[model samples]
Target: MSERQKPVLRVAIVGAGPAGIYAADLLLKAERPFQVSIDLFEQLPAPYGLVRYGVAPDHPRIKGIVNALRDVLDGGNIRFFGNVRFGTDITLDDLKRHYNAVIFTTGAIRDAELDIPGIELLGSFGASQFVSWYDGHPDVPRDWPLDHTSAAVIGNGNVALDVARMLAKHAEDLLPTEVPANVYDRLVASPITDVHIFGRRGPIQVRFTPLELRELGELRDVDIILDDADFGVDESDERSIATSKQLLVINRILTEWRSRETGRASRRIHLHFYSRPAEILGSDRVTGLRVERTAPDGEGGAHGTGEFREFPVDAVYRAVGYFGSPLDGVPFDDRRGVIPNRAGRAIDDEDERVHGVYASGWIKRGPVGLIGATKSDAMETVQALLGDQSEWWSPSEPDTDAIPRMLEARGIRYTTVQGWHRLDAHERALGEAQQRERVKVVPREEMVEISDPPATAQPT
Candidate 1:
């Protein structure tokens, strides 16, 4: 057959987040020997996974990433199958039968574990769960317990900052954002008055972005407290500050806040550097956090100083990091919480390539990097996938329509691209009525119902 008459290369990407969308975008744009057809499947009814569900509602700057991902999905070069799960709605064997290759980009959803005593206390929580609750993630419970007046957030990353800011910010301040009614209602009822953020390393070693660190001070009615002693920096820390611009800005901001007079804000956020969590104290619930002071080890790391201090707090949130959940048939490394892969190609227990299967983003590598970094990561995965086109699994008479047929036979109420557009319009309409940006639909059933196309219309 002529090159123009060759059958299209069908590819299925599981997960419609930035990572998966970027992979689809690259695959569609690549100069390949055959035309490519891409299908992006998402477990949620909505697209832009983390951008829509994980980002703090108040952070519009970061949420602006949705527009770029939207452009790719709106290009019509790819088909979006929302609300379709992999393990349940469809399986690996099903995907292989319909497409030439499959890519998994289900980014990490669970929080990384922090080994510490009393971590299972009643008041101890994972920052990821709190983030999801406040972000209006459909799967999480609508009501989050906020009885604690003081909370301790352990981590130095952006997520840690997000959790701290959310707990400390006045609910009225979040009104203009896309916070759902359920989340807003619960947040306003929170008795939280103080939120302490602890980092195991020095100020120069914090993983938070400069903007996020700056935003902590911008919260209304919240005073940022930094102990004068916590401001100590060694020669090596100073060297790191000079070398990394982010570190320099972050350190400068912290230093400036250290000199500021404490205001009578109703809420307070305490940023403590060089404090490592040794234990979460309390018999029934979190009443205090036992932390150990640390000093720079002069090798760009920290060493415990053997000085123990306990801060009385009602709740504890561990925001150390995130870890990937295992997919039904994917080869996962339990220790690393990532799919075993080499340059995006899935590897088996023997470390041999699992042809036709691949991974990208946090699942390919560990949960790290921002959205921009995720795009670059996708590029690498896509390049590797394209390079192995010669060895890709080709099903006899591959039919892209088979997967949808299977879902229909199973009675799965899947959401389509058009359905998403309708859902988007519905949200915008809701926001218009309320005179806000957009009011998110929190319940999964509501989202699926609203995003579902008319019964007369067939699934695309």
Candidate 2:
């Protein structure tokens, strides 16, 4: 308590995902006058949010990003609180008691609605749910009904391709990655033969990154089937492709895929462009997918051409997009599925900034970007926190130990960064026994037990 010492800028960031982690890192490194103290709160026993539960495990290239995130969490400058639900385990008033400000980084996890008939069928599913299931998310169901012989994936993004790839990929090929034992077993038992990915626009208008698009053509024992009509690009399409390197690469890859023979492979993925979902055809479960053929309107989008086609798909997955859920005590914009915010500073219904409250990542701006974009996105929110000093919460008890004691008093057995290491070691040990890189722990109770072992339990 010296007069010369600067006051600590205590911040509590909800959701220890890439966005929240990035915000903490930037705040710690920011050229500010005062020292920064951060506490990261996560809902899962694990961290990494979407990266841990939303990414396809088969893609190892994305795992490298975790190293950077790990560096931040392990830096010892931030407190890591895992397995703590924000609203139930802790609340806004609870956070206000321990920190000067709070930042919500709870990114989108729900699937954007696709308004079409029969979408509520038993066999139709949102791609986010499937992604969660396969990624070993603690909350989703472990068993997936891979009973379908043919399936349809609706969307033009990388997620659509991921759904198609997972459906058609051989489970034997996934042994090297961290696919959960339960998911691996289910995939090994799937009878899926063909998976069709539908896009409303042509190849040039697709939202897929070139790398994800190229991976489709690389699956072993799986042939990519495409129709010549889907690739018939007009002058405008050609110009659009030429203007963007991404489109050119996608065009080249699709051109190569178009020339390939299909029946030679044991499994197949069909790419259908200029097709919009008219209905998910089924009674209790999906039996088919009816799509309306669309044509370019010279405005970069497509319009229905009164032509329709049906594919005999037993399951349908909509990878339309991810949407954010409303937080318990935050101003939310239901239309956009994000917290009402202006430049990362959370706003109220009157559009006035809510002092001491902020949002970042998909919760602030919808789910649209990749992990790299999250860094810059978080910096904006961090700047808002650093730049503004007015109305910051004057916590009565800013002690770091107080919040943990509160959780303990509430009988919440939350996980810590050290606990994460233990759980991680356990998964790696499991993978080692199986001669793989890693095996994820799926069930919530098991993950919690593995990460935060009971006090009387022997050392792991």
Candidate 3:
């Protein structure tokens, strides 16, 4: 048979995030004449993984990437199955039975804890949880103890800046966007003033983009503080930070901070460098953090001196990184903090290919790159699938027609692209009525209900 006459390759991508979407886009546009049918699964009711749930609400330009993705979703070839979790609703056996190849692009969902003794204490929350709460994640618990005057985020990454900026900004500033009503209300009433972002390394080693770093100065009612000590950098360090234009922009901002007059700042985000969180101090709730000062030893590692200091804080957040969730029938690597994969093929501990299985994005690469990076990552996985097409197992001779059957069998409710558009329309109308940007329907049940047809279905 000619390549054109070859059977359609039914591809199941486990995530609807950027990585999965890019992969689907590549397969849809492949010139190889092999028919590729993609089923994109997302645990959330909405698509655009981190863009929707991890990005700060103020960054509307960043969020606009979702529009570009809508074109792909509307192409009518790829199927977007939202609110369908892989581990809970469906199993690996089920995906293999339905599709020829499965790509797990589910990004890291959990944050790395400091693992300190008082970490389990009340006021100590993970940065992921705080970020999710502010980002209006439907699954995040709403009642975070944010009613504090001072909060400390133990990291110097962009996420740390985001959390600090959120705390420093007024609720009215966020009212224009789509933050959850409850979270918005709580933030407006929050007494949080001083937001200290700590870094074990110096400011030169900070991972925030220049654009985000510069945005800190735009906070009208907020103060941006940086000690000259933090800004002090050697020749080698400057060269290292000069690779990206984003880092250059950050350097420019720091260079100009001394000349700018930032007025009317009751709430301020103080950027502190070379300080590491040694311990979180409190009895039942967080009261402060014990920090140790460190200096760069000319090598990559830091040398901590015996000297230490304490900053009185009400809440503490550790914005280190995120990890993938464990799914049934999938072999996970706790050490690497990802699903074990060999060149995109999901492998057991024995290093043998778990046929018909695959992985992509943070779940595959342990959460490092930006949205654009997913394209190449996904392409790599797709190439691997193309290489080993014959080894895949198909439980059904023909199409298992899993979508409709799975929806019926497990009473799984889902939203189509059109349905999502309708909900989008509804949200826009509501936002217009309220004189605000699209007021998000944050409750998962509400989103699911809108996604559902006339029949009443129980919430998941």
Task: Judge candidate 2 at residue 160 and give its lDDT.
Answer: 94
**2 against 3, candidate with superior lDDT:** 2
lDDT of 3: 0.81
lDDT of 3 by residue, 209-229 (tens): 887887887876887777776
Alpha-carbon error at 89 in model 3, in Å?
1.6
For model 2, the local distance difference test gives 0.89
Mind giving the per-residue lDDT tens digits that candidate 1 earns over 298-409?
8878899899999999999999999999999889999999999999999999999999999999999998888778888889998898899787887764776776777778
* Cα lDDT for residue 166, candidate 2: 90
**lDDT (Cα, tens digit) per residue for candidate 2, span 1-460:** 4524988889999999899999999999999888888999999999999888888998889877789999999999988888899899999989888889999999999999999999999999999999999999988878998899999999999999889999999999999999998999999999998999999988789999999888888899999988898877555988887689888898899888877777889898988999999999878888999999999888899999999999999999999999999888889999999999888999999988888899989998899888868888998888888889777989999998898789888878888888888999999999999999889988888888888734323455
Candidate 3 TM-score to native = 0.94
Candidate order by decreasing lDDT: 2, 1, 3
> lDDT of all the models against the reference?
0.89, 0.89, 0.81
What are the clashing pairs of model 3? none
- Model 3: runs farther than 4 Å from truth? 1-6, 233-235, 241-245, 259-264, 453-460
